[model samples]
Structure formats: C-alpha cells, structure tokens
Target chain A: MNGDAYWLGVASGFVVVGVVIEMVRRRYLRGRFALVWILLGVGAILLALFPRLLERAATALGVTVPLNLLLFLGSIAMLIMIMQLSAEAGRLRERTRVLAEEVALLRTLVGSADEPRARSIAAEDRDQDSPR
Target chain B: MGTRGRGKVLVVVPAYNEAEAIAGVVASVTRAVPTADILVVDDGSCDATSAVARAAGARVATLPFNLGVGGAMRTGFRHAKREGYSAVVQVDGDGQHDPAFIPQLLAALEHHDVAVGARFAGTGDYVVRGPRRWAMRGLASGMSALMTTRLDDATSGFRACGPRAISVYAQHYPAEYLGDTLETLVIARKSGLTVTQVPVAMRHRNTGRPSHGSARSSVELLRAGCVVMLGLVREWPVIADSSP
Candidate 1:
C-alpha cells in the first residue's frame, strides 16, 4: 500500500516467524504443525518485500482486486487448518473413550475378585471360556 | 449362537445418575432373567448409582467419568467378551424397558444375531408427536432401507445381542449421542449380523423425566442423522461366527 505499510508488514511477518520459532523451541508447538505458520510468515515477508508479485498473481487469476485474492486464500487456509484440528480432536475423543472403558472393565475384574460369589462365577466363566 | 440353549447370557444395564431407579431395575432384570448374570455399569453419576447397583446383588462396573450410554454399554460388552458370555441383553437403568420382554428378545436371537425391542411394532401404547415423531420416523425408514428389513423403532434402547453381535460391539461401539441405538444398529447390519425386531411395551420412568424436549429434540435429531450417515459410510469390522 505504501512504504510505511510495507515496512510494517515486513516487521509483523518477522514477528510471527519469531514467535512460532520460540514456541517450537519451548516445545509448546509441534514442529510438524508449526511448519505451516512458518511458511505463511515467510510468504508474508516475501509479499511485503515485492508487492508487485501479489498484484501480478491476482491479475493472472482474473481477480481485479489483489487484496480480495489475499483474503480469499487466507480464508481457505484457515478452513483447512480448522478441519485438521477437528479431525485430531475426534481421534483424541475416541482414544479417551476406549481408555475409560478399559479402566472400568479392569476395575470390575479386580473388584469382583474380592467377593466370594463373583470368584466362583469368574472361575466358572474361565472354565467355560477355554473353548473359545 | 442361534438360541439361548446352553449359552450364558449377561444383562448390561447402563445407568447415569439413576441412583433412585437402578435398584428396582436390577431387581426386575434379575427376576426376569434369573439364570443370566447382571452387570450394571454406572456412568460416572454424581449420586449413589454404583453403590445402589452393587447393593442390589448385581455386579457393577463404574466408569471414572461420564461416557454416555454407548460408552458404558461398550464397557459392559467388553466385560461379557472377557468373561465368555455368549449373549448380552441391554436394559435401560431408567426402568422404561420392561425386563419381562427379555425372554422374547432372547427367543428372537434364535434366527438373528441382534434383536431390538420395538415400541411401535403394534404392541406398545407409547406415542410421540411433532418434530420428535417425524425425526424418529425418518430414522426408522432410513434404517429399514439399509437393513433391508422392517425396523419400526430404530431408536429403541432395549436390545439383545448374540455372540457375533457382542464381538462386533466390543470393538466398535460409538460413544456419541444416540450412537448406542442408531449407530449400533448400522454397525451390526454392516457387519453382517442378522437383526430382528420384537414388539414390547415401554413403561414409564420410575424416577426422573426424559432427557430432551421439543426444542432440543430437533437439534439432537439433526446430529443423530449425521451419526447414522457416518455409520453407513464408515468401514466396519467383519463379524465372523465366533461360537463353535
């Protein structure tokens, strides 16, 4: 947009890259997931350094407004990242449910062993279970 | 696996905050299926559900936190699998499902691997109206088409599972809302388990009111529809005849 704006964009891009690197160094963000943000930060720095590149690319794609193209691409990137997060959450939920089930079942086995009737029933079950 | 002939049965009652009704439910189930073992899974209730179920002379498996009916039922199925039970019949801890109908359910297992206790199969006076009824009808029709057999009440919680059904459920039961009823049926049908429906009347709850209402029913049904759709397209495990 202007010289001051270009410098601001470049500085902000560097800030983003520095924060991501720091998070990765502190083990707060995984390297695999941080790679996307690192690339985005580098792309922002390059675009700020050469503003004509974005306008040219937008024009080649038949977009009259370069900023609109940037916004559109940004939205798609956000949606993709959000979808990945949701999928990861679903996997974690499934694993947690399975762990809860296993813990409950294990507790039952140990709890039943303390009672006499359950002991006899469990023994009978073990005897009958050999065929399977 | 065809019948209850020489096969041990386990009644899995999944309870969440049903301390007031768990005892009576356990007692009735025991009276109805005296020969069968009873396992009441307390789904992390804040009340005395686990203690009450344990006091009722039924074995209790207590989850560390709430996992809904599907999770508790899966826990029960895993226990049955490990303990060598040949069949499992699920009775709701709310006392809505009549335990006396359990024999009829087990009898249906003679030909099918899974038997559902249908409320609208021309026997029960249970009625539903408005959006809830429409949603249930849509699900029933969709499931009927998928299973290639009539399923009058696809959302019925009362059900019986043979050895094959037990094995399939122990591995892939969904913990999502309505997954215990609708998704489990889809999984069973997808896994090659023959499913049948038996007419049974539901009783009124002994303690609390039903969970959802007219306003929430529609939203929950929409989510449930997505669950059934996922169940349809999801890759299911093959269920081999495990009973020799």
Candidate 2:
C-alpha cells in the first residue's frame, strides 16, 4: 500500500531471507555465488525504494517479465529447477569420471585377449574327470 | 625375421585368471604339439593361473596388470617373434580350443599365410548345444562372409599366422572392444596376405560360463558387425574375387 507498509513487509522478508541466504551461503551458494545472491537482494531493495528507477536497469538486462505476482513466481521456479539440474549433472559427471578410471585400470590389468573364465576351461573339467 | 627352428611353430596362449584350466590346457598342447614351445601370457591372475602354467612347463610371461585379451596376445606375439617361431597360433587357456587341431591349422598354413578355424563351416563333429549358439554361430558366419568376401567363420578365436601376419597383429590389435577379430582378417587380406578359413575341429569349454551372456553376445555381435562393415567398406578393394 504505502512506503511504510511496504517497508514493514520488507523488514520481515529480510529476516526470512537472511535465514535462507545463510543456508545458501554456508552450504548451497558459496563464494562468488553468495555475492551474486547479495547483489540480487540489494537490487530487490533498490527496486522497492525507487520502483520506477531500476526498471531501466532490468530493461537493459533484457528482463521483460513483470517483477510482481505470478510472473515472478514462474521465474523463481525456473531458476530453482536450473540449479537442481546443474547439481545433478555435476554429480553424474563425477561418477562417469570414476567409472572411466576403473575401466582403464581393468583394461591395463587384464591383457586384451580375455579368455573369459569359462572360455579358458576344458571339456574334461565339465566331465568331472579333469584332464591330467 | 624368419620362421623359427626351420619352421617350429610357436603357439601363444593369452590367459587371465584361468588357473583351473591352464595346467590341463598346457598339458594337452604339449602332448599334441610335442616339439612346439608354448608361451602363456598371464595377465595378473589373482588365482593360481600363472603358477599352474609355469608348473605345466609353459614359459609364462607375467604382465604386471590385466591388459585385456588383445594386449595379452600382443605380448605373446612379441615373445613369439623373439623366440624365432616362424608362425604363431593363438590358443585359449580354456579347453574350448582343441589343441589336436593345431596340426590341421599348420597344414593349411603351408599354402596360406593366415588360417583361422571356422565353427560353422557347416561340418563340425559335436553339437552346438542350444539354438542360441546356433543362431550366434550363424550370425558370425554371415558377418565373416561380409568382412572377408564370403568366409565361413569370422568369430573363431583359434587362428594361426605366419611372422608377416603376427607382426601386423602385434602392432594394431584393438585393445578396448572385444570381438574385433574380423577387422584383422580384413586387414590381413588387404595387406597382400591371403586370409583363409581352415576347417579345424572345435570343442566347448568345460569350465565357468561365457563372459558375454546371451544379451551381451547379441549386442556385441551387432556392434562388431557394424564396425567390421564400416572398416571393410574403407579397406575392401574395388575389384571382385573373394577366396584368399
């Protein structure tokens, strides 16, 4: 409604955000990423104070969507999904690297002509009276 | 450079963790090819394979680690070359390859530079057991035909090659993917050497199970076929005759 009413909401939101940002900083978002989140929080505050001013900056960044209500929720969801996918990809990539190393070691250890365990045995062994 | 001991053929057996069958195989080979020396390339067997091979009197060359089948065979060929064996026959440590048939392969090698056994040349003594093997053998036959300009068996592991042939294999053996032997057959023919199928007898292995189960077998055969087809397309001469 009014600027004071918005500030009251903003103050409570900051407390909630401070907790979330701590989670992101200490565990999820670290280093430069935490700095990016801080910048985003500062930008949100700047837009709250001068709602019409930062619209030019957002326009320059090619952000066309409405920063309020439903459109904002959609963008937030999209960003979270991208983060989840990126983390999963990082884990998968690490696993693939480990598997590749294992395969290489096996290739080196097992000489190329692998006569699988069975292919190496005789009919005599199968017959019970093993070959002498 | 030349054939060893005025034509003393050296058979190279590449074995990995084949302790159970190594001694029996060594004994059979020695009994079968009395004069020919046997060299076993033991690929870091966790079991007693190396000890058994050595005890059976095969000159066991221990690789520090497992180098897969291609590397083991290559190592054996290197030794075979040094030992002056005019020719090298690769026999598996498993009893699947009948050593008695080595002479038959040698006889065929008299005229041809490289002779490989054909499991489905259509006239083998024993039964192939199930319909799956029958089907696989049929596919292998067809694959051989496509790669070598109409040959009987391309998947046969039992093969004999002269020094010229051995040198080529020792150099370009594909280490990673298994079942790429047909590539060698094609390369051998292209290298001005005749690649022929020697209809020697083959027996089933008595020990464990096949490394490639039915599903893996099918997938591997398909992959091998595609790779071989592509390779032959690149290397197959434009002209027309097939028999080599």
Candidate 3:
C-alpha cells in the first residue's frame, strides 16, 4: 500500500479502537461485544503498520493476493459477529418472555389479594365518570 | 383467595381470544370438578377473555402479551407450585376437552405422575385425517417408546400433572409451538415421572377455528418433527438431582 493509504488505514483503525473503548466506558456497549471489536481494530492497526506481516500471513494461508486474505478474514469475522448477535438476541427474547410470565403471575396474586379494594375503587371511578 | 372447598388439585385453562366460549368452559369445568380450583390463564387475548372467565367463576392470570399455550401453562404450573397445590389439570379454553373426564385423568394420576386424556384410546369419536393423523401417530409411538408405556395421543391438550410433573413443567416448559403438549411429555418422562393415559371423549369447539388447515398440516408435521428432535437432544434438568 502507498504511504497516504497506509496512514489512512492506521488512522481509521485508531478511530475505531477509540470509539469502541469510549462506548464501553460510557456503558453504551457491553464489554463482550466491545472485546471483539477492539481486537479487530488493533489487528487492523498492526496490519497497516507492518504490511509485510500481512503479506507473510497471506502466504502462510496459501493466498496469492494479500487483499483477498484480508477480505476473507473480514468476512469470517463479520459472520461470527452476526451469529453471536443472533444468539444474544435469542437469550434476550427468552429472558423477556420469562419476565413477562412472572409479571402476569404476580399481577394475578396481587389482584386477588386486593380484589375488594379494587372493586370499590372501580366503583368510585365509574361514579366519577357518570354525568351529574 | 377463596379456597373454601378447594382441594389440592388445580385446573389450568390456557385461553387466547376465546371470550365467546370461555365462560361456558369455566362453568362446565366448575360443574365437573367442584372441589378443584380453576385458574384461567388469559394469553394476551384482544377480547374480554379474562373478564368472561372471571365472571364464570375462575381465577384469571392475564399475560401482557401472547406467549402461546406453553407459556400460559408454565405460568399456571409455577403458580400451582407457589400456592402449594399438589396437582394441576390442563383443560383447553375452547371447550373441546370434556371436563367430566378430568376426574378420570386425576384418578390416573394416582398411579402415575402425569395422566394424559387420550383421544384415540377408543372413547372419543374425535377423528383426525391425512398428514396430521400420521404425524400424531408418529409422535405417539415415539413417546410410547420413550416413556416405556402406551400413549395413544401424545399431543392431547388435556392432562393432569402430579407434584413431580408440576415441578418439572413449572421450570422447563418450552414456549415453542407443539412444545406445550409433545415436549412437555418428553420433559416429564426425562424427569423420571411416570406417565399414563386414560380414554376421554372430546367435543367439537364451541368457538374459534381449528389450528391446522389442509395446506398447513404438512407444515405442522415438519414443525412437529423439529420440536421432537429438539426436545430429545436438548439437555434437561433431572428431578432427582434438583433441590426439593
């Protein structure tokens, strides 16, 4: 890569690393997700700083083109991230369903205990709603 | 709160938008099992199912959103566990299940932890056809082998669960389609609870339509296969190891 392109890659990598760290610090992003992204950003910086390392990795992986190697690794990383997100979403949905069920059961318990009081309050509300 | 003559058994009716027939269902269940406390679990119905069931003299638990029958039954089972009930009988809210057979189901529970009201056990004229029938037979045979007993209708909604089955279901009932019936039986068997079946007569639904259409019956078969496979492969909690 040319000097300007190399600097651009390194700068973008630093930006990505900084933004993710800030997000984690502000509690906007969970540490588990942030860890993957931070590592990705650091890898990008390393590859940009030492282009020879990328060439060697591409050769070791039996890829003739270094850019193709980068693209393949990036694709795999995205796929893994997406799968992790799907798994997290499923867990969240299950948790939400459990919470909703618990709420329904609790409401039933409270409603039964407060039935008489609730009836009188309902009666008062109906009385207030009626035209004078 | 009114446990006047309420026995240890609770009848849990999982209802979803069955306002038209809920009152009648509740009434019939009450008439059949006067000593058993009736609980209507309103599965986020858009209609007045909860009010109708309450008016018909059954305690109602209204979910905030629809979580299907599995979620509703789990709520019922958990409530039964918390309230110290010894057993739970599931009666469908659509009035298809005859509450008169509830006594027979409960009686079966005397010898087993789970008693299923089997439709094809030669009592009911309830006939299923085509792919749905074949799928049900496949499930029944599979469950029979697993439980080491004959279960004519493994997907029967009408069932009575003793304390052990109640505990197992309260914690691990799957909210997926067919899970409330098929997977629940699998869970019961996996938990080392003995299961048995009693012949019961089923009636036509007073309201609402049947869940499976001819076109969808094939899809339902595929879904049932997935559910059974998942239930068998998934790790389950052993009742023997769990804290009492």
Top-scoring candidate (DockQ): 3
Q: Taking the tens digit of each residue's C-alpha lDDT, what string does model 1 give over B1-244?
A: 1232336999999998899999999999989989998999988776778778999998888776778999999998888777778789999999999999999999999899999999999986888888878877877887899889999899889999998898899898888778889999989888889999999999978888877876777787788789889998999978746562
How high is the TM-score of chain B in model 1? 0.94
What TM-score does chain A reach in every model? 0.80, 0.43, 0.83
Cα distance off (Å), candidate 3, residue B181: 1.1
User: In model 2 chain B, where is the ten-residue run with the lowest total lDDT?
Assistant: B235-244
Candidates sorted on DockQ, descending: 3, 1, 2
lDDT by residue (B36-119, candidate 3, tens digit) is 899999887767788788888889987777789999999998888778787899999999999999989998877888899999
lDDT of 2 by residue, B219-243 (tens): 7667666756655665543221223
Looking at model 1, residue B39 earns an lDDT score of 91
Ranking by lDDT: 1, 3, 2
Between the candidate structures 1 and 3, which one is better when assessed by lDDT? Answer: 1
Q: Which 10-residue window in model 2 chain A sums to the lowest lDDT?
A: A117-126
Task: Please give, for residues A31-123, the per-residue lDDT of candidate 2 as tens digits.
Answer: 655665566566556556565654665576677743644357448956986897699787775454334323332433454365344223422
Docking class of 2: incorrect
In model 1, state the lDDT of residue B222: 83
Q: What does each candidate score in C-alpha RMSD?
A: 7.7, 11.7, 5.7
TM-score-based ranking, best first?
3, 1, 2
lDDT agreement with native, every candidate = 0.86, 0.66, 0.85
